[model samples]
Target chain A: MINKLRMGAAGAVFAAALAGTPAFAADNADATATAEILESIDVTLVSGTSLDFGAMVVTGAGTVSLDASTGNLDCSDADIVCSGATDIAEFSVDTASDGRTLQINLPSSVNLLRAGGTAGNAADELVLDGFNSDAAYDAVNDEYTLVYDASGTNEFAVAGDLTFDGSEGPGVYNGTFNVSVEYN
Target chain B: MIRLAASRLSCFLACLAAAGTFGIALPVSAQGDLLVAPTRVILDGRRGTEVILSNIGSEEATYRIGIELRRMTSEGQLVEVSREEANELEQAAMRMVRYAPRRITLPPGQPQAVRLSARPAVELPDGEYRVHMSFRAIPKPQPVEEQAEQAQGIKIKLIPIYGVTIPVIIRHGRLQATVALSDPGIVTGEKQKWFQLTMQREGESSTYGEIRVMKRGNSEPVYMVRGVAIYPEVGERRVTLPLSSEQAAALKGPVRIEYREMPEAGGALIAALETAIG
Candidate 1:
C-alpha cells in the first residue's frame, strides 16, 4: 500500500513534467527535451487556533504549562492561579510523497512583553520556553521529527510553559514565536 | 452563490466564536501560514535556481529571508551556529551565495519566487559547503486601544510566527561519500519498537536517502523512512526507526536493511546489511 502511494506520487511528477514538455515541443518541429520539478511538500496552520495558555494570575513567581499531547494545563503551583479555556497551536502538513519525514523546529524561548509599553523592558515581560510537541523528539540532538502517514496528511500540536517573575505590571502582554518545518 | 457565501460567513463566525472562547478580544484571521517548495537546494556549479514561497494564510504576510549557519549533529539535528563558531568552509559558503529581494510581502494565496545563485571564491577547497536559508514571517503590530478596558490585572495574547529553513549546499569540486550500516538491533520500549543503527559516513559530502527493513523472503518493506540525511559534520549518525507492534513481530528471524537514495533520485542503494534479529 505504501509503495503504491509512492508510485502514484512519482507518476504525478512525471505527468507534470510531461505537461511542461509540450510547450517546448510546440515551439519546435523536432523533439525537444525539458524537465520540471513539481512541489511535493505543503504545510499550513489550522484556522481559528492559537497557542493560548488562558488567563492566569501571578501571586509571586511561578510557571504554568499546557501539555501538547493532552490539552491539560499544569497550574498546580502555589504562587499562581489559572482560569478559563486553553489550547495548543495546531498545524496541518501534507506531502505528495509517502514515507517522507519532517523536521519540526520550535523556538527555545520567547518573551511576551507588556502591550503598549516601551519594548525591551525585562520587568514587564513573561518568558515562554520548554516547548512540547506531539512529534517524536530526538533526545540525542534535541530535535523533533514527524513522519507522513499513508494518506500523506498529518497534524501536530505545540504547547509550552510560561513563567512569570511576579514583578510585571498589570496589562495585556503579547509576543510572537516562530515554528519551522522542513524535509529531514 | 448565496449558499456559498453563507457557508463562508458561517466559517468566519465559527472561527470568531472559537477565538472568543479563549478570551481573544479580536477576530481570528489565520495569519502567517506559508508554504515553501523544493525544500532543500543543491547548487553544483554557478547555475542558479529558484524556490517558490507562497502565503497560504488568509491575510497578507511579510517574510524576511536570511542566510544562516547550521551544523548537523550525530543525531541528525541541525543546530544553529554563530559566525564565530562557523568553520572556514561554512564562512566561505555564506559569503559566496547571493539572493535577491531579501524581504517580501505576499498577499494571501500568492506565490513568489526567490532567485538564488552561488559564486565560489577562487582557490576554494574541493569539498561541500553548506548554509541554511531561513524565511521568517514578521508579525503585524497590535492595534492600540483608545481606552484601557482593564484598570488592573493582566491579559496575554500569544501569536505564533511561522517560518522554514532549507539547506543550500554548494559543491565546489569532486566530492564523494561512503556509508556503512552497523549496530543493527531492535529495541522494544513500553509502547513502541525501534530499529536502531549507526550510519557511519566517510568523505566530503553528506548521505541522504531512505532506510528500508524487509524480511528475507518478503518483497515489501516492513518498515521504511525517507529523507534521512547524515551531513558531513557527523561521522556516525544514530538512526532510530520506529516500527508498529505488528511490524515488529514480523521483523523477527532473518531480515535485510537497506539504505537507498530517495525514489525520485533514482533510488540507488547506498548501504545494505543482511542480518538476523531475534
Candidate 2:
C-alpha cells in the first residue's frame, strides 16, 4: 500500500510538470492574440515644451463654423451690435479611424463661450470678468468641450487692467472683457 | 430678437461691435423659470436636449439666444471658433445653437419659448474650449414721464421705467460631429473625393448655420468652403463642402468645425484632424 501511494504521488508530480508546459507559453500566446486585434492610440497634449507648436500637419479633416452674433446675451434696450460676428475656427483630427470616433480626455479642455459685452455703474463697471473656463465631455459626439478658463486667474493684471475706457482707450481698449466657460 | 449672454448684466454697447444681444433680469414673478430651469446649468452634450427659455417677466421681451464656441488646440493655441473657414476640424456638437427670433416681439406676462440644443455633431473632432450660451436683449425704450400734479390733493413722482427681460434655456442637439482628414492635402483646383461628411441641425427651436472647413492653426485662413444656410423645425437634410486646390495647398494644421443647429444657432467649435501636404 505504501509503494502504491508513492507511485500515485510520483504520477501527480508528473501531471503538474505537464501543466507547466502550457503555462509558460500561455502568456505569450495571449499576447500574440491581442496583437492581432485592432489597436487605437490617442496623442495627448500635456503642456510640454519639447513639442514644437509650429510643427504641424493639416489633416484633410474638416469642421463647420459656429460664429454668430446672436449668442451674445443682451437686453433689447441695449444697443449691442451683432456685426462683430466672428467666423469659427474649428480644428479636427482625422485618425486612420474614419474620423467618426472622437476620443475625449480627462478634464476635457473645452467650454462654451460668450464674449465682448460691457456694463458700467458709477463706482465700478462689472465687466464680463472674461475668463473662467471649464471642460466637459460630449459623449454622443465623443469629444471634449471647453470654454475660456480665465475666471479667478491672475492674467487680467488688475482691476485697473480689467477696467476699460473704450471712450478714451486706443487700439483696443480691451473693453470690459467678461466671458466664462465650463464642461458638462 | 436679441441673443442673451451668460452674465446677467450685458453692456448695451451703443457701438455696433457687440456680437450677441440679450439681457439678464429675473421675472417679476418666478413662475415658469427659476422653478423650472436654473439661471444656468451644466449641459450634458450627449442627450441632445432642448433648453426652453420662458418669458417669466412681468413684461415681454425680445430674444436671440445662441451658442458660442471657444477652445485651445492640442498645441495650446486658441482655435478660432468664429472664423469663416475651418481653422480647425473642430465639430459643433448637439446642434443646440440658435436665437429665439432674429427679431422677436414678446407680449407681457406671457412665457415665450426659445430653445438652445445640446446635440453633438455627426462628425466631431477633439480639443475643448470655453463654450457658453450667450444672449443679449434690447429692452424697448420707455416713454419719458412728464410729472404733473393731477390735483391739488396728491402729487406722484412719475419716474418712467422700462425693461426688456429675456429668459434663456440651453436645449441640446442630437446631431454629432466627426473629423475627416483629406488625402494629405488637396492641391489648388485639385478635385479629390476623400470622404463624405454629414451634418444635421436638429435643435428644438433654432436656426441652422453653415458648415465651414479651413486649415487648422493657420493664423490667417486662405481658403473657405461655405454657402447659404437653412432653418429647420426637426430633421433637416445634410450638406456637403467642396474644397478647391487653393484650399488644399495652403490649408495647414487641423480644421475647426463651426456651425449652427437652428436657423440661427450657435455652438462651440470642435477640431477634426490635422492637415498638411501629404
Best by lDDT: 1
Q: What is the TM-score of chain B in candidate 1?
A: 0.84
Instruction: For candidate 1, give the lDDT.
Output: 0.73
lDDT of 2 by residue, B218-276 (tens): 43335433222222222333322333345444444555444422121233442233444
- lDDT tens digits, residues A1-184, model 1? 0000001122111111122222233332333333444444445677777898777777788888888888889999897877778989988765555677778989899988786666677668889998988776656456677877856347789999988887877777788887887655
**CA lDDT scores, all candidates in order:** 0.73, 0.26
The interface RMSD values of the models, given in order, are: 12.7, 30.2
User: What docking grade applies to model 2?
Assistant: incorrect
Each candidate's fnat, listed in order, reads 0.43, 0.00
- Candidate 1: deviation at residue A136, Å? 1.4
Among these predictions, the greatest TM-score belongs to 1
Off by over 4 Å in 1: A1-31, A118-122, B1-29, B146-152, B188-191
Model 2 local distance difference test score: 0.26
